[model samples]
Each structure stands twice: as C-alpha cells, then as structure tokens.
Target: NLEYQGAFLYGEITANYDVRNHLFEDIKLRYDDIYKGHTLELGNYKYMDDGAREWDISFKKDKGYIITGSKNYVIKENVPLGSRVELLYLGIIIDIQNATNGVVEFKNDEIKEDRNYQLKIYTPDGKILIKDISTTSNYNQQNKGEVEYDINIREDHESKRNKIDSKVYYGLTDHLTLGMGYLREPELINDEYEYLDKGRLEAVYSNYIYSLPYTFRVGGDKVFNEFEYKVNEKNTKDDYSYDFLGQIDIKKVRLRLEHESKGEFYEDKYKTKFYVRYTPIKALDLEYEREEATKRDGIYGIDYKEKINKYSIEYSKAYKDLLLTGEYEYHTEDKGKYSFNTYYTGLRTATLKLENTWKNDGKDYEVAFSIFSNGNRLFDYNLEARYTEQEKDKFTFRFSTNYNNWFDYEMFVDKKGNQEHKFGIDHITDLRNPTAKIKNMDSSPLKVITFVDKNDNDIYDEGEELIKNVEVQIGEQKINTNENGEAMFYGVPNYVTYDLEPKIKKPNFLLGNNKVQVQGKNTATIVAHIPVKPMLTLTGFINVEDILELNSIDKMRLYEELLVTVKDTNGKVIDRAIPDEQGIFEISGLLPKKYLIEVVYMGIDHQIDGINDEIVKLTYVDVRHVS
Candidate 1:
C-alpha cells in the first residue's frame, strides 16, 4: 500500500509472500518528506551512490556467483580509520561497519548477484562519500551527434534456452533520432531447439510543427522463424507501426491529440485520442478526453471497435487559513461511471476529503483525513484516518482504518535475509545566537575623523588638535572618536550613501562634513571640522548718586535700580546687567570684538575693548532740586 499525504510527505509499505516456499518475505517501509529533504526506508531496498564510481568486485545472478580476487570485497583508500562504512542498495543501508586501518570489508555472502550497490563512507568532517559497487552505467538522453546502445541476455532455466535482445539509437539531429533493435529467442519444438529472430527499425521526431509541439514515431519489424520455415516453407513476416502526438498551448487552454496504428500478420489496430484542458479562471479548470480504437482481424474478417470519453472539472478556492476544492469526473466506459471528490484543508497541514464513485457494478463512498506536524518540543507525527463503504447489487460493506506514526520509522531488508529498522525524531529549535559574529564580505569600513580646523582649511593639519570622544553618526550607527580622533564604522554596505554627522554640541564649535558615500571595498572617509570660537567676558561698575533731599531709603533704591547695558559697534544691545548696591556689574559670553558700554540712568555711553577684556566704570548723577 502506498499513501500520499500531500506534496510534502508520502509513505509506502509493501510485503511479499512466497507460496512455493510457504514463507513470508521481508516487509518494506518507506517514508519521504520532500519539504525537509528527508527519507526513511526499510525492507528490501537498493542503494545507489549519489556519485559515480567503478566497482572492484562483480557478482553474477546465476547461482549467486561472486567474481572477485578473494571471498571478501575490501575497500582501502584515503578513508580514515574508525569511520562508519555503510553498504547500500537503491538508497537503503544494507550493512554497516566501522573502518579498521583505513579499510572496510564485506563478505561475499552478504552481497547479491546482478545488483547495483553503493558504499557510503561517513567521513570525519560530516561528509558522505558515495562509491559505486556495480558495473551499471548512467543513462542520459541522446544529444545531437550522440549514440546510445543497450544489450540484454536472459536464460530460461526450465527450457534450457537463452534469449538475447539489443537496441541502439543514434541522434540524427537535435530533434530526430533513429533506432534499431534485434531480438533472438530459442523455442523448444518437438524435442528440438529453434530460434526466432526479430529485427526492427524505428525513427522518432520531436519538434514544433505549425507552431504546435509534436512527436511522431514510425517503425517496421520483421520476424524470421526456423520452425515456421520447416513447417510452412515460409519464415519471414513483416509489420509496421506509426504514432503521432501533438499538443498546443494557448493562453490557459491546452489541447493534445495522439494517433497510433499497428499492423500485424493477423490483425491491425488503430487508436486515436484527443484531450483538452482549459482554465477559464485561476480557481477553476475543465478537462475532457476522447479515445477511439478499431481492430481488424485478417483471418476472421471481422472488425471490432471501442470508444472512451472522459470529462472532469475542478474548482478550488482559498479563504485565509482554509482551502476548499471540489472535483468531478465522468467516464463513458464500463456502462458509464462518475466520481465526485471534495477536499478541505486548514492551516496548510491538515486535510479532509470525501469521495463518491458510481459504477455499473458498484458504488463506493470514502472519507479520508490526515494531518502533519513539523515537530516541536514534543515530537513530529503524521496521522491518517480513512473510512470506505462499497455497495454492489443488494450487498453493502464498510471498512475503516487509521494510522498514527510518531516521528518516522524506516525499515530495510537485505538479500541475505538481514533486516534493520531505523527510527528518527525531528526537532526544530531556533538555535540563533544574537551575539554570533556574521561577517558580510560585501561590506566595507567607514572612517570618520573630527578635528579643530584652526587654520580654517578643510584639511586636517599636523599641529591641529584632534577632537577626542566626538560622536559621529553614520546611517543608523553611532561611533565615538578615540584618542586619535578617528571613529570607525564597520560593515557598511558598499555603494550606498549614508548621513555622516559629527554630533558635536559644544558651545562655539561648528561641523564641516555631514554626508559620505561609500563605494566598493575601499574605506570611506569623512572629515568633520569642529572649529572653536574665542569667547570673552567684560566687567564694569555702575554708580548712581542722588541729592540729599531724600531719605537714605530712597537713595539706596535709586542705586539698586540702576541698569548697565553693553552694545556692539553697531549700537545693537548685546547684553545687559544689573549692578548691586556696591555698583559692580559683569557681562560674559561675548565674542572677541569691540563693544560699547552705557548706563541707562545717565544715558551715557563709554567705549570698551572686548578683545582685550576691559572693565567699564560709569557714574550717574541725578540733578533735581528737592522736587
């Protein structure tokens, strides 16, 4: 039994019984997860190397004959000692042993005759080395100017007769091929062995014909029988066959047609088939097929005919996390039959299906369900359920089955009657480390330098001081300058533009460059000039005097309310200060330039040198006669 659990995974189990020996042969189990690139297989499976190699030993199927220098097949190469060595056939591990002294050996008794095998050597570096152990060659399609041939010989033990078959094909052109085949078989007739020889010539052409892709094959065969010549004095018979297949694809519609005819000595048969598939919309598809066959019997002078017609439609739609599909098929054969199937899938991992099939002899109804999990903290599993009902005439039968396989189990059997079962558990965890160092080969470094442009030049000078601990922002990364006044940003992608800004917030300092373009693998450089300004402070004293007509309280208030103002050369008030009763005042944060100081009460101005940091002294006299 084979079960396809969808496109991701599938399972198959097969067992054989030998009636003559009254014994049960080995049972095979195989499961494949295409999505994960995993396979588990058991029972009698053949192993072939993923690569190609030459065999050191040969085995013949007749009497299990082993042809080798010794009874054991030994492999000695660059293989490391203690490495695991596995003998496999058709991708199934048959025997496993550890290598000793860089050599691995298998006894002849464990090998089968006339079978292709492979040796899988597990290297120390977690690599598998595949070696072929058979003489089979790989087959590839014939290319232009290429020739391919195959020969086979078979013996009939009961009749003591041998048959030989050979075929050869040559590529006449890229799209055309010519082939020839010959078969010679022995027949036991009247206690004598007679041979019948058959020869055939064929040609195949595949190319576009009138804008439609097509393939056509024409062949003729002749047979020569020694026994027939002895009985009827005529031994040669000729026959011919031809077939044509063509397909056209236009937009969402596909049409295919095939016609074939075979001529024989007693009868001639012809068949033609036509098929079309159309998708009117993305979620709907329609298909139809018609086939007709006719046979003419030369001896009986009778004609027989048969025809088949098929029609099918499929519709599928998806709504968020759920998918629904419906399909119906009708066939015009065997008294006519039709089937309808529906499927519902959720979360892309679980599916439910219902099917109803009607035939002239019986009706079958079935329901199937399956679910798959990719594996988590617990374990991965595949579960399936099926129920079937059949009705024939007045009788009805029902059957139901279920399968739950945890993890994955694959079994294999060898020709030596040895069996091995392998169980696997899949667990996926996010093993990502945030601190892991991943290097980007395409990225380049960015160097940013910050300095005080003392000479007012855009370039950095030797005597100029480099500004240390200056933060620089490049793209989304921020780096601080070292003692060398260099901030380096690593892993900057090449050929991209980024904003390079020196985040300097110091008073009286300015930045020069704010953008940099990185290119190739070269390091990008950004120069930021943080020029400083010479700031100065000025101090002064303001004195106010009033007549003795008022009291001491009024005299103190007049002095305390006095104000002093400092202005630039253009008479724009740059700063102001209020003096205390002691008449002392000061002004700061002025650039190195000339400024004027004035007393607001007296309305008098005085010049003070800002560049030299001179203090001002002002005297204000209030002139009022006791009013």
Candidate 2:
C-alpha cells in the first residue's frame, strides 16, 4: 500500500510466506509498550515422547552428557576482603566471647505486593524470602503395541512443599552469621516410608577473610534430603533434594565448589552439581548451570523432576542504551511431559523484539522489529515504526506505521536450512497535545518553588543565593521554566517535594536508553527555594500491633497521623487526624517505642511519602505464642 493523503500505509507486510498454507494469514500490530503492565498470561501445551519403554538407568552406554553447573556473570570486586561475604561464609555455630551486636547476620529476600488495594509494598529488608511454593506429581505406565490383558505396570505418586520453616539464625558475632531452613511433611507419609518427605536443616556461616587481596571464604551445606520411595515401592511424599556449594572470590574471578548426594534408591541422578560466573568489568558477564539426579525416585515419571538442566549461558549489560543480550537454555524433564493419560503441561513463550531510533532533521523516528516463535516455528514478525516531531514547547506530531509481515522471508534456504517467516505492525497517535492539564481551581499558579543553597551550606542561612533551574515537585507531578523560581505542578497531589521523580521519562531520553519507568509519590524534594519543613504530627489514637489504617489519612503528614493514635487496647485507632502546614504531628496516642505503634507515619520511621494508603508499618511485627 502507498501513501494516501499523507497517511502512508504504515502497517506494511515486508515478509514473503505462503499464507494459504498457514493457520494465521498476516499478523500486524504496533503497541505503546512491550512490557504491558497489569497482565497475567496463562497458557498450556503438550508433547509425547515414544522412547519411554526404553528407559534404562545405565550411564555406561548412554548419551555423552556433561553434568556440570553454570553461573551468571556478576561484578567480582570482593570488598574489604572480609566485608564481601554471603551468609554461608561466616561458619557453623562459631562465636567468640562478646562482640555479638557487631555483625548483623541474616539472609533476606522479600517481595510483597499487597493486592489488598494493590499495595505493592516491595520492601527489601534482610531475612525474608520465598512467598509460596507448591509441588505435585502423578504417573502410570502401559504396554506399547501389544494386545496384552493381564499385564500390569506400577502406578503411584505424591509430592508436596511443606510449610513450617525454621528461620533459626544464630548470629555468631558482628562479622559472622549462621542460619538454617528445615521443612517436614509428616501427615502424608502414612504407612509408607517411601512417601515420607522432609527437608533437612540447611545451615551456612560467613566469616571475614582477614588479610586478603579480595574476600575469600568457604562454607558447606548438610541436608538429609528425603526420598519419594523408601525401598523403591513408589514413595508417596518422601522425596527431597540436597546439595552443597562452596564459593571463593579474589580479584575478578569467582570459584564454586559443589558436593551433592542423592540416596541410592534414586538412580541416574547426579550426585553433585555446580558452576559460577565472574565479571572482569561491570559491562561483561558470564554464567553456567548444571544438575544431576542419581537414583532419583519419581523424577522421570510422576515424582519430582529427576532429569537434568545443563549448559546455559546468559549475559546482559546492566548499564547500556543499546544493550546486547543473548542466552542459550536447554532442559530435559519427563515428570510433566505429555502422554496418553494427561497430556497438558509446560507453557513456553519466546519472542524476539528489535527496536531502534534515529534522529535527523530535528525529528525522531523509531522502528521496532519482533518475532514470536513456538514449536520450532516462527509464528509472526511484528515490524513496527513510529516518528515524532518535538520542536514545539507544548505539542508534537506523532506519526506511526508498521509493515504486516513485510520483512518476512519464509521457506528461504538461508545457507543452513529451510526457515519459516511471517510479519505485521501497528501504531496510533494524537496530533495535538498539551503540556499542562490544569484542573481543580481555576488557573492557580502551579508554582514549584524549590529553595537551593548555592553556597552548599547545610543550613539555609541568610545571604545564600537560591540555585536556578532546580526542580520542585508534588507527588510525581512537576513543571519547569520560570523567573520566580516556581514551575507549574497542577493536578499534583498536595504533598510536594524539591524533586518530583517522574512517572514518565522524556521521549528524547527514552529514545536513547530504551525507556525507564520511575515509580513513587514523594513529598521530599531538595531545594532552598522553599524553607518550609513539612509539619509532621500524630493526631490520632494509635496503639500497639495496630496495622495503621493509612487509607483514613487526610491531607496530613504521616508523622502527624502517628500522634493522633495513642494508647488504646490493641487494635484501636485515633479520631480524625490531620497535619499542619509544617510536616509535624501531635502524638496524642500513647505507647513507648517498645510497643510498636502501627505508625502510618514515615521518616521518623521510613521515608515513604505517598497517598496510595500503602501502610508503612513498623519494621517488625510482635508475634504471640500459645501453649
């Protein structure tokens, strides 16, 4: 298609493929962003392997496979020799006299997104990880091509991830730490020791590597991993895995020592698996992964995954405008493989996306190339392009067009073999745009006045000139350019700051560095233009253990909200709470710092300022015990 009245046929098909022989003719479309938010994709697929009956656990005459582990590239600068250490480096239950509070010893990993009003409170506090884990299995074998009748094949299975976890972390000292993880599934092990599943306590210790070029340490793991089959009679829930990995780092190299063991009941499984990656520079990375399940029961059929995942390399540039990324992943598992009984499992999604932008003639144009592949076939190539003109102060012309499979070259013998190809593209735009959407009060000066001290004096002493071009913000809303040092922050949520981190990046900046999503509603900005400290206070009645009901806060500072809620029978809140012009709060609520006040406030607590009602509770919760 050609340009018809300036609106060129943007969505073009540049690929050549026999559409008449495929399920989908031409796939074409363009979207605003690739990582579309608010989406949960669910899909299913199936596969059947005919070489099942020939399942032999003999490693002698089998395929030549390398059962070694791999690692991902990581910056390898071991800091302060001993300071650069993981939890396992400390040492097992070793502590000297006194000097305890010195070394904080805990491994923490936590991701919490409270859907309770979409409160994505992703706090990275140490020592919290693993939300939910689930495991299941089922299997049955049958004759291949026989009219057999009375012939029978063993059928049995059971798998589960037990709850109860022993976080028991013994802080040996300020520089050393030790901890363990224990799990057990008792109720499911009924009369069969084979089905008795339990995870042994996992422990680790990290110690400061005194006097070394880089942080160097060694640690080990002792896990009496349970099994699914006690005597190979189809262990119901008794199947577990355990492995030990030792690590050492100096200069820019990282080494890993792995020694694992699988009970003899399970065959063909590896006894140990390990690998490590070391980065010579921040821009380069390397990795490898390996696994072995020796005499592993229920792994091949309906037990746990007894197969191995090996030889995968993945590299990525952490900081780069145009990043080069590639990875090779290969795995073989029979547990969930498709079969005649239940043939639905494993959903793998792969897509190749290519995007590039060019600036010339004071205008910017971006072209996106993508290919979605599945089942060893190229489903479609979405080749899209967009152009924009930002020569004005308020508006720009955004013109986008894409080729529907236009770049597709299918069944083409490309020096190697015959490959299939398909293509498509899409885009849309608003010719007219506005810089500021002033609403609420009729034309109030959305002034963003930030006071910056040119002298770099900590105090805003008199005679200190205010810095120009500095930013002022209000809940992620901001504007710039003015003489009075104030920019428009219209429609901004009251709690303003010296800098309003953008909810969006400038198109020019985005074009160069792919794009960045900066999220957060802050009332904290750095500036000398405004010499006002947010009045913080506690106006409501707060009590111990009460998860502060943040949703009830008005245009008040969090500190003020904490003051209102005072001494009350556990779980009581304060009456109406509000804040003064200054971010200050009146602590009407009673309670020592001992009994944590579900302080909805931050700063004196945490510096999270937002109106989203995502409560910033105390650092830790007080748990009750019952006999």
Candidate 3:
C-alpha cells in the first residue's frame, strides 16, 4: 500500500493505492478556506468529522460545499440558473430548492432557530459548495441560543447497503442542551432481511454544581424493526438510559466518578466507575480506576444477573534518558484474572533502544528490542539492528529477528518456536536533490576585499596590487580572500554591523584600517586598505691604504672595528652597519627620505648624504698616518 498527501495553492490533496487489493483505493480533495465559513470536498470523503459512520462509497466525482452556521443568518449566493441546493440539519435532509434567475436565497424562518444548519449547493458545472451557518456567529452573552449537529453515512459495497446517522443538539438554557438522533441500517431480523430504524431523544446538563464540575445525559431509544413478512407482530422496541459524570480537583490530585445505565439494546447493564490521578511532581504520574457492572442475562429463558468488577493502576516516571512505566489490572467475574505489565526505554517511543547518529559524518547506528505479552504469557519479542552510512553514496543494513512464544514455560519446549529472521541491505548512489530549494528573501550578500595602498591614500588605485590568501574575520566567520582579493558571505542578515579585521602582519607594512565596521545591506562591498611602508637599502665599499702589508686576518679585522650609522632628516639614528673583509657595508630599513650616513674609523668621521635611492654606493677612504 502506498499513500501520499500534498497541498496545492488553495487546498490539500490525498491519495492512496493498495497494490494487493484495489489498485486505486481513493483520492480526496478538500479546501477549507474557500470562501466565508465554507468547505469544499470531493472524491471519497467522510460525512462526519470524527470518522464514525457516514462515508461516500466509490468515487464521488462531483464536488460539494459544506456550510455551518445558525438560523439567524441568511444565505445568498449567485450561481447558474436551476442549480440544486440542499439544507441539512444534523444529518437529515431538511429542505431542497433550486436556483432561479441565477440567484438563490434561504430565509431565516425556513431555518429553525437555535439549530446548526448546513447548506450544500450543487452547481451545473459539477461543483459543490457547503456552508456552515451556526458556528460563525458570536454568542457572548449566553450559550442558550447555540446549536450543534453531527451527521455520518456509511456504505457497504459487497452487501450494497447504506447506513445514515444524524444527531441535532440545541442549547435550551445556559447549562442544559436537548438533542435528538436517528439511525437507519439494514439488519437480519428473525430469518428475514429488513431495515431497522432507531430514534433517540436526549438531554444533557453540564455545569458547576456547588463548586463541583458535573455532567449528566439522559436519553431514550426506540427501535422500529418493521418486517414485510411479519406485519402482524409487534416490531417496535423502546429503551431508556442515562449517564452521569462528576469530577473534583484538590491540589495536585483529581478524582472522577461516572455512572452509566445501558438500556436493553446494550444488554441491560449498569456500570459505576471511579478514577483517581495524582501528580506530586512533574516527572511522575500515578493513576487508579475501578469499575463495577451488573448485567441481566437469560439462559434458556432463566433470567439471572451477573456482576463484574475491574480494577487497574498505572504508574509512569521519567528521569533523564530513561523512562519507566508499569500497569496492573484485576478483573472479577466468573473467574478472577489479573495481569501485570512493565516497560522501560531510553527513547520515548522505543521499548529498549540505543542509537548513535552523526549527521555530519553521515553515519547512524541503532539497536532496539521490543516485547509484547498478555500478563500471563509472552506473545512475541523482536530484536533489530540497523546501520546507515551516507557520504558520496548511501548504504543501509538491517537485521531483525522476531520470536513468538519466547517464554511459555511449557512442559515440552518447542525448539522450533515461531520465529522470523530478516536481513537486508540497500545501497543508493544518489541521495541529493531530495527536496526543493528555498531562497531566503530577508538576507543579503557581503563582499570584503583587501588591497595594497601604494599612494598612502585609503582608496585602492588602479595599478595597485591586490593581496591574496589573506584571512578576513567578519563577525564570527573567518574567510580567506580569493585570487580576486575578495571574501564573500552570502545570506547575511540585513541591517547588522560586522567587524572586519585583517589577519596579516608585515614588518614594514601598516594597515590603513585595522578594524572596519561594515553594515550588511543589499549586495554590499567593502575594501580593506593596507599601505606598504617605504624601505630602502644602502650599500657601499671601503678603500684602505697599504692593504698588502696586512694578512687576510688583519684585513678582515680592518673594517670589523669600523662602524657606520644612518640618521633621518630629523637627526634620529635609524640603523647601523659594519663592513666585512671585502669592505662592503649595507644599511637597510630606511624610509623614502633624505638620510645622513656617517662612518667612524680610527677616530675619523666620513659622512655621505644618501637620498631616496634604493641602492646607494659609496667609497670610504682611510687617510690616517702609519701607526
């Protein structure tokens, strides 16, 4: 069997298919908000909301309308000429009319006051409209003028039988409601087939009497079993019944009492039931119920009375990952019988379950054990294990075993106890595109770029280079700039401020804006400027006299004691360097400005003015007397 349910623009649709039985079981279309307090339904639909009795047999191709409201309101609608209209109260067809001059109207007098009425319209275009009249009204002062109704219809295809049931209720006063119902069905009576009609009249009262909530319903039923063959015999039977329910609440405990007297149609039985429930805390619940019933029965025309009493208690408690539940029932009739049951589970629905699921890793594991019994003997037990893995492909493996009569404790053990074992594996290559994509309309995209600012200006110049592979932290997300020096974040909430910080630290480079505040608007773009610091290196050689008189070690130490210092225009010492045996000296980390380079050797100072040249070469001469 396969079933599917979906919603369209206006309403909902449901379809079912039974491969083993009827291939196309049924399909239904329902629209609840079609018009003002109206419902439209087509195909196989239930006549009653509670799925009790009334049902459309086969496929109802023509759509119909269901209207609910009270009699004080009038219904006026424009439709095709000569359209058929029906008014149903409870479940009974009360009136039928036809449209004239492209319009139809239902007056208030034609409608009974304080009664729920339904108007079903069948247009010429195979469309049906139903309007509910009574439920749309506002009755704030008193409920005395309100009315309700229930209707159900059932059809049996094999027997070609149809059953109709309907009930109408009216609030006579603030606390009392009067109702009447009718039911008709085909039955086999005394070797003769006939249609039995049942009618009932009931009154219900619900209110707080002396600060105690109570409700009572009294009704009488009359059955008419008119037979064609037995016309002379009496065919009418009547019975009366009543039910009373009361409840009292005291702090965390609640007590309830119910008494029911069933008529002859229900075996002429009387039952009294009591229930108590207590909850001292939120995690625990305790409940108990007792019922006593007396029934009159006749065996071979010997009338006798039988009495039965039943008692049951239920307890439930939940703690962290585990839940415990237990129930016990005792019944006293011909032979006393008792049963006890208990259940425990880590998961709310599973009897005994263990599972580990990792959605990101695409792996899931589950093991479960379940058992069912009738308190006296074990019925069945099931053990199952399932593993699922979903990465590039999806794979699932399942193993299960079911054993019947697992613990019967019989004299002769049945080795081949009723058992079923199943093992299956499924592999799916593609689990993608399983659902439709939805676009977020409330968010925007934000793009951040980082670039080199060579002109000392905050703006990015045309020829300026763009920095790549730089990390930019926006909000809580860190993204690396692509080759285009752009980091994009899509679907960012609008009208929010995010702090942008660059994660690059260079020795001679200063970021124009270390921290930037960017607002996420529609398609926003921001740039982080980094200014490259000016740095120059100065290199020169030294000229020494009588170089041949010294050895290589002496020559190497000739400039070892010679120190060179560089100062900016402000006379601040920027850097210092010493010459090697080759008489080559280099000074680095100088700004793009005029600097003074001074060399001190043998207490003699040689000064050279170095401009903004990337490589400054100079020769220092040692004009000292022979020592």
Ten-residue stretch with the least lDDT total in model 3 = 424-433
* Sort order, lDDT high to low: 1, 3, 2
Clashes in candidate 2: how many?
112
What would the C-alpha RMSD of candidate 1 be, to one decimal place? 23.3
Off by over 4 Å in 2: 1-170, 182-199, 208-242, 264-270, 276-282, 286-293, 296-320, 326-627
**lDDT score, candidate 2:** 0.29
lDDT of 2 by residue, 1-627 (tens): 110001112211111123353322122111111121111111111112221111111001111111222311111110110111221101111110111111122211110111000111111111111121111100011122211111111112123222233333333443333444343333443344332323344434333365322222223333344434344464433234455655555556555556655433445444555555556665243544455544534635543444365443433332221234333334444221110111111224222334333334213443434333222212322222322344312211222122331232322222234344333321111122234442211012234343333222334566543333434345445455355545544333222223443222222111111122222122222132343221123332223224344443433444454432332334444333433533333443222122223334444644433332212221112322110
Task: State the lDDT of candidate 1 residue by residue for 1-627, as single tens digits.
Answer: 111111111233334344454444433343423122233433331222222211111111111122466123333322332245666544434345555433466662225322456777764323456777653211112458876655556554445566677777778888888888888877655567777788878777767656765556666666666343355343245344666666556778877777877754434488899988888997577888899988785447887888888887766555544444555667776544444444444444223444455555345555544443311212223344455565222211211111231254445443345555655431111112324221322234456667765454456677777777778776567778888878766545433466566676566455653443334222233233443332345655443343234455654565465566777766788888876655666676755445666665532232222222233322112111110
User: Where's the lowest-lDDT run of ten residues in candidate 2?
Assistant: 111-120
Write the residue-wise lDDT of candidate 3 on 282-316 in tens digits.
Answer: 52345556676766667765445555554544444
Best by TM-score: 3
Model 3 lDDT, full chain set: 0.50
For all the candidates, what are their Cα RMSDs to the real structure?
23.3, 27.3, 25.5
lDDT of 1 at 263: 55
Shift in Å, residue 106, candidate 3: 44
Which stretches in model 1 have alpha-carbon errors above 4 Å? Answer: 1-143, 146-169, 182-197, 209-211, 224-240, 244-257, 264-266, 279-285, 297-300, 314-326, 335-362, 372-384, 391-627
